[model samples]
Every structure is written in C-alpha cells, then in structure tokens.
Target: MQKAVQLEVYGRVQGVGFRWMTKLVADKLGIKGTVANQADGSVKIIAIGESATLQQFIGAVKASPSPSGHVTKLIQTELADVSLCRKFSVVG
Candidate 1:
C-alpha cells in the first residue's frame, strides 16, 4: 500500500547534497514528495509510496550517508501535505 513518511535528519545535513541525494533515492523508489533545508540546520524529507519501498529508502539514508553524515537523529512521521504528489523535488 502507498503511504507517506516525513524524515528530519539533523547534524551537518544542510550544506551537503542531502536533498539531491534523497531525490535520487525517491526517484529510484518511484516515490513522491519533497526534500528541503530548514533554517534549523536540518534536512526535511517527505516521501509517499509503498511502505516497503519507503523503508528501503530510509535504510539507504542510514547506510549510504552514514559514512559522511553524523546523523544525530532520523525522525519519521506521516505526511499530511494534501498537495503532495508522485514526483520528488528539492524545495528551498
């Protein structure tokens, strides 16, 4: 089933290519949502798609970026953005 998940990755996440790399993951997973840099030095990622795929993408985030990213935390929540769709993007 399709679902939406919002992830907030903190700690040196803003300046890196986090959003673009996340877009790559979402695109590969056939998911939809947006990723952006917040003012609080964090990256906000939102994705909607099959639960399994979403989980896989999350795992990717932890694994691939784990080496360079000192992720202090990864928080996931349900996306309530009604305007969300099936194409991932990088929001300013």
Candidate 2:
C-alpha cells in the first residue's frame, strides 16, 4: 500500500546537510517528497512511497545523520492525501 507521512526531525538538524542527505536517501529508497529546514531549527520531511519503503526510509533518516547533524527526536504523522511527488527534493 502507498503511504505518505510528514516528519519533523528535531535537534541540530538545520545548518547541516540534513536536507541533502534526506533527499539522497529518499532517492535511494525510490521515495518521492521534499525535505526542508524549518524556521524553528527542525528538518521537515514529507515523503510518499510504499508503506514498507517509507518505514525503511524513515529508519534510515533517523539512523544515518549528516556528519554535522544529530537527530534528537523524530515525530511522524500520517497524511491522508499524498502529494504524489515525482522526485525527492531539498527545498528551502
């Protein structure tokens, strides 16, 4: 089944390569969505893909942090409407 989720990653996520790394992970996982730095110093990710793939992608994101980034918390919320993104991207 296809699924979409909104994730808020907290702690030392901004100012690092978090968004870029996330995009790379998403691409590798064949997921589509956007990753951006939030004003509150969090990294926001909206990903759409297979349910199992999404779970793996999320785990990868949490486990693999950027060299300068540290993930302290991850909050995930399921989205009812998938964005049907064509590709993963790093957005500002």
For each candidate in turn, the TM-score is: 0.85, 0.93
- How do the residues 1-92 of candidate 1 rate in per-residue lDDT, one tens digit apiece? 77888888877676667677778877888878888888888888888888798889888776545345566788888876535775888889
lDDT of 2 by residue, 1-92 (tens): 88999999998888788888888888888999999888899888999999999999999888755878888899999999876588898889
Predicted model with the maximum TM-score: 2
Global CA lDDT computed for model 2: 0.87
**Alpha-carbon runs more than 4 Å astray in model 2:** none
Report lDDT (Cα) of residue 6, candidate 2.
94
In model 1, how many backbone clashes occur?
0
